[model samples]
Target: MEEPVRWGVLATGKIAESFARELREVPGARLVAVGSRTQASADRFAAAYGGRPHGTYRALVEDPEVEVVYVATPHALHLEDTRMALEAGKHVLCEKPLTLNLSEAETLVALASTRGLFLMEAMWMACHPVVRAVADGLRSGRFGAPRQLHADLGFVVQVPPEHRLRDPALGAGALLDMGVYPLTLADLLLGPATEVRATAVLDERGVDVDVAVAARHGEAVSVSTASMTSASPRTASLATDTGRIDLPGDFHHPAYAVWTPVGGEPERIDPPEPVLGSGLGNEAAEVGRCVREGLGESPWVPHARSLRVMQLMDDVRRQIGVRYGADAAGVAT
Candidate 1:
């Protein structure tokens, strides 16, 4: 049997833990090391999966036995961690909202291409069975051009000003954290964005608490929204000239989605695997497959698409006055 790819997980945060847990379920993958800011955290994360605990991300990146390093840190740290891995000649799978701003994302993309390494944003949603089904429908014209789409992902969390969700230094805001989901959902079906106009509510700390983004691409239109101070779980739908598809609750990790044609019975889509438990693994599988194929990017969550999404986010931020600290004017340059 072929050897599983040696994976080193960087960071011991919630996303890091979740990705590591999901990696274990993916075949042809093995978690060999974990790196954390603290030795104790690294030890704890590694002990769970029989991996070596490295005291710093550099240690994990430089480990010759590790095939790839997964950067699961906060959005602000994505560029740094991914650069470290690429500099170390290791492939990388960086978490979503790929970078804090478009300039940062552009730099990372150029680096990855120059180094000829496989770099992908862990937009696991694009790899899930339900999401793929939607993509297939749109591509096959089953949904008749999918002229309309509406998706909202928001929740009310007690985020103080100091929390990452509210910290300006961390790119804390609904647009970066929760809004990326709906925005990416728009991109999945709408293709490249031609125009975008949005409005948002700002927090006392100057971060946006909620943002509603309406994007237009020729004849197709998509409204994607998110809020960090409210509860809105019953808001996921896709419409075309033919009909609308209603995704069940928890649209992010849906078990089954219903497609309804114009004045016709609703058809159900049941995915073979229940991605609800650890959907992160699906993207990990994509990374492994791309590596095996010697591809620099996965078609599911390609680096180009991530950059486009970041560009869209850049526009939304400009509209809402919620800019990353350094880029207060939100200049792309």
Candidate 2:
């Protein structure tokens, strides 16, 4: 409702810090407060972004000066935090995988609709110009219809078994963390998958460390593999009937992508003018643009689309037997 959208951050983790730094760089975005479980962390993050410190999420959400809340908590906590922010009558921008399951995601969508609130999932890559160009090209009939897709996102999960990546309580695994990006990419372009046949490498702790999923969208198929045990970095590529789109290392961040047509030289494309700078701030820009336009969600990463992706993730969990402690305790879906 103001020149700069007042942002109330709900965590002090590395992602929270990185996103807050980006918000500072965006012209019409302002970091108003940083909230954490502890006051010290809040103070530190607020100081970093030149904002006030809130000792708890409640304090930040109820702050009159804050227009929106960015939920940067772990995967398992996304549902609860986003619900709290929406209930408080503040717009919410939550992290990916939206929720731990499809049911919770549907609940959030209904709640936002009932409450007249704006909500979005932070699939920042989808908001980038590179991804938009690819989508537009596909719809323009220039790239032709999408046929097959190959995507891989893996990282070396070098942490103790007690860490979140290993802790079932935190909803840790390769599918929810690394796999979401590639799966989302396919969903954004090729559309909803009717079915998925998957296989995975379950670690000794009963957690799936390596997962391979192949989904069918009518005749077109999308395939992806994700791992928490590999030392190799990560990579993602998209192939269409007309040409192939190549994304460099760290595919999530906006970068140079080559569009190679059949038997033709590749052309390079970048983000548009408004978001042409470092891709880090694209999500913040999306939030501001949507709010300015009086829209309830972003076309780039809509809440309904996020819910569909979460269902895919839930299906992946069902295919593999990676149940969290909360699920065991009947607290999760």
Each model's lDDT:
0.85, 0.83
TM-score of each: 0.96, 0.94
TM-score (C-alpha) between model 2 and the true structure:
0.94
Q: lDDT winner among the candidates?
A: 1
Q: In angstroms, give how far residue 9 of model 1 lies from its true place.
A: 1.0
- Model 1 spans with C-alpha error above 4 angstroms: 272-276, 328-333
lDDT tens digits, residue span 41-142, model 2: 998887777778998988989889989899999888988999999999999899877877777788888888899888898888898877788788888887
- Model 2 pairs in collision: none
Alpha-carbon runs more than 4 Å astray in model 2: 274-278, 325-333
Which digits, one per residue and each the tens of the lDDT, describe model 1 over residues 206-273? 78888999988788898888988888873679888998888776687777788899999999988856
Root-mean-square deviation (CA) per prediction = 1.6, 2.1
Give every collision pair in model 1.
Answer: none
